[model samples]
Target: MDFELPEEYAAITDTVRRIVEAEIKPVIGAYETSGEFPYPVIRKMGDAGLFGATFPESLGGTDAGFFAITAISEEFSRLTPEFGYAMNQQAMTCPFTIFNWGSDAQIERFVPDLIAGRAIGMFALTEPGGGSDAAGAMKTTARRHGDIYRLNGSKQWITFANACDTGLLFAKTDPAAGHAGITAFVVEPKRGRGYRAHPIAMSGLSNCLRSCAVFLEDFEVPVENRLGAEGEGFKIAMNALEYGRLTVAARLTGLAQACLEHSVTYSKERLIRGKPLGEYQMIQQLIADMAVNIPAARALTWRAAWTMETGRPSSRAAAQAKYFAGNAARHAAQAMADIYAGYALADEYPVKKIAAYVNMLTVGEGTPNVQRILLAEDALGIKDTDRHPVRNRARGHLSR
Candidate 1:
């Protein structure tokens, strides 16, 4: 029943907070204005061991565990949501997946650079067709040759695609086999042939982070780069997402807290009718909603993190956390906009950016509708989320 985070985890949080203030806060605006990635800040974070929280010391990580990574995500996003995504992209999905399901040689080759932020990593799962039904509707295919697999397909909404030195790319090896046909490959775009990335301009996180449409035409990946056996891609992707959703929820919680803090500050300073805006009941109500929602979202996220850390079935908890946290972030964004009124739209103020970030969060990880459907199926005895092979495997590995 202990709710407090361990002292070591708290120390990690404190270090990240300092890094954000010293390295990010000072230069983030310039990067946003220029629409550029903050490589220096990222390197600083890497130097501070921010990206290595979940890995063992042998792999250049502290093995701080899932809860520590979740807390670190929250601290990163609290001030800047764009940087928070780096935690997930670089540490959570791509590297962790490779660590979990990859061969010893593969882990030795990629994990250290990724966790050190010496290399950027991307997770290429969602296709142009659709993300919610990624495995079912996947258009990507990986055909085996001699020592290499020739891959061809276009991936949509791929974060860090434009800059990733390496990534986990999924494609169907046996297209007729449906979900079971999918296979995972570690594609090195920097050294590999036939990999093209076109950045997609978006309203949110446009400046600091780049989401792209990635086209793989006759791309050659070595046979040794394959993760697990053929047809295990879907399972690996889902397992990674079980971890990904927690980070997503943590980011939303941080965003909600930021909105609440900003609203409270504005309420005290904004004068209307010869009194501060905080004096108004309507303003109080909006702030109150944010105040309430933020903690609830955070609590759910922590619960999910604990579940994953303890090697328990976490799909239900992750979904619940992500669903509630996304809604909370959306609500907080709206409240911030309402409180700011005309100022919310101005670039000088962060409200507009926060709102746009919230909009993206709604669809990331899993959409609200998608999460609802999963939960519904679970509740109706149609699916036993706790009884998956992935969860069982995770239990054995994570428990250690």
Candidate 2:
């Protein structure tokens, strides 16, 4: 497959690069230090039309493909991985699912706001009691009553839960149908709506807002708010996640790139024993390995994006890409930290921030062990011990 980006895609990527350089990188550390979510910067991203790259122009997007989206993700992440998180939450997880499964009316009502960045969206699938076994452990129920669905259940680890305008909420509609019983709804936390969201504090992922545990008790959703139809939520969730996994891969690739660049610059400039660190064979090896892995991860990410664009099943490729890219990022971060020594532990060094970002990415879209299991099933055709196996534990709604 041709890996070279077309001129048009390059232009879009270049625009994203310029935006990151001019806007995001300068203030990322301040935002992280203050424990803020960078709302104004995200609004600027909306003005730049970064939120709708993959959607059609009819939906206020640029009519871009997933490749362009990948490029945007990589560049933004290279500068500030937290911004990458926000971008993915917007470009991939939130709006993509809505456009695909939402009713036409729902699309009309939400898509424009999303593309315009007037409102942010989030996906709510994971729960407190259920981890990866969401289908079996789903305690959230949507009871059919009169003309509305009464949603009762709590979703845990919901990203942007406190800041999002709409969420793709999953609930079990038919308790007896197992996975087939699940249904998805468009839940809006507004004055007239029946929804409430509370923030969950977290120390591990302080760069962005940690996912929240939202309790939906007697949450009333209009019958029209149901996405697609009943019993179709699982498929919708999976499809959205399949694409979402690729974004995670792309974002990790960017973070790895940052680590490598920072490490290389430090090695070249810092003198060790009357010689620059770059002259040492061991440091050279680390840098070489990083160079080798970054592009390799990038290729895998591009292939996964291409798979989606070409109407192919990307589940296996997505799993592989996310797994490999995450490992590569972690190693890069560790290697950079070692090279930087004490400086790596401080936030001023960017390597420490890179380390945290890598830690989050390794488990964000999917965990490495979970991806291996997915690859095993895809390659060997061996069914997992759990028949309802999920690809990534991070996105699968709980820890496996």
Candidate 3:
């Protein structure tokens, strides 16, 4: 129940907040308008040891711990939601999956470059048919060949799809195997070489993530590039998601904080009648609700993070965190908009822009409705604690 973060973590969060204010906050709008990726911002974070913040030092990291990474994500998201999300995915994306399940050669090949920002990476899971039903609706397949696998599939709404050089790709090897038949691969995506991408006309996170539909048309992949055993793709993917869901929670929490801060500032300066908006009971109520939700969501997210760090199962915890944070961000966005009235629609203010980011949070990674079903299962005691097998396996890898 101790709410205090360690001194080092606090200091790092402070620095990250300043960086977002000075760098991302000032220029993110331009990037959004130009539809360009923020290579310089990613490089700055890499230089600040953020890319390697929580990874092992042996892997060219600073061993900053996962909680610290989440803290930095939270601070940056307040200023620019896309920036916060991009930062987390930049450090995580495919590299985290490689560290967990890739063969030694694969890890040796991708880890250093990804962490150093010399190479880029991302995750490919969602498809055009469905996202919530990821396993059930996945149509991508990797057919076995003598020395390589021929991959064919279309992955839509893939974050950093066009920007990254490599990513963790999932495709079914055996349709009858159902979820068990899925396999994971680290594929190098190059145009016309079995890999092509078309930018998705997304409403939010346009500049932050640069999402697209990646088409793997008979792409050749070396068998050695497989992340895990033939049927282990689902296991590995779920495990990565357990942690990724927490990261998403962390991002949503940051957006909520932004909403609260923006609302509070507006309340003080915005005079209504003879008094400031802060003096009004209805405005006060909105602010109060927003203020309360931010910490609640944060506490849930950190608890899940701490549990995983302890090598404990986190499927349930991650779900709870994601659900709470998503709901909080959504409500807080609307509440901030309510406070701003017409100003909410202005680009100079955040409510209009951040509301879109809220959509990204609630829908990406896992949907809010999906999270609710999980929580209900947990409450009903129908969920198995052993479902998330990847957490322990990942811990074993990190320990080694």
Top candidate (lDDT): 1
Task: Give the poorly placed runs of model 3, Cα more than 4 Å off.
Answer: 1-3, 21-30, 390-394, 397-400
lDDT of candidate 1 over 1-400, digit per residue (tens):
4356679878988998899889988988798788776767777888888888777888888777888889999878887788887977788888888888887799889988888888888999999899999998799999999999999989998988988887999999999999999999998999988999888987756566888999999999999999999998898888888888999999889889899999999999999998999999999999889888988999999999988888778889999999999999999999999999999988788898788777787788879999998888899999876656444222356221
Lowest lDDT sum, 10 consecutive residues, model 1, at: 391-400
Q: Write one digit per residue (lDDT tens) for candidate 2, span 210-287.
A: 567787879898888898789988887876777788888988999999999999899989998999899999888889
User: Which residue pairs collide in model 1, if any?
Assistant: none
TM-score of model 3 relative to the true fold? Answer: 0.94
TM-score list, all predictions: 0.95, 0.90, 0.94
Estimate, for each residue in 65-153, the C-alpha lDDT of model 3 and write its tens digit: 67876777777677667766665456765677787777678877887777776666788988888998888999999999998999998
Query: TM-score: which candidate is best?
Result: 1
- What RMSD, rounded to one decimal, does every model reach? 2.2, 4.9, 2.3
Stretches off by above 4 angstroms in model 1 are 1-6, 390-400
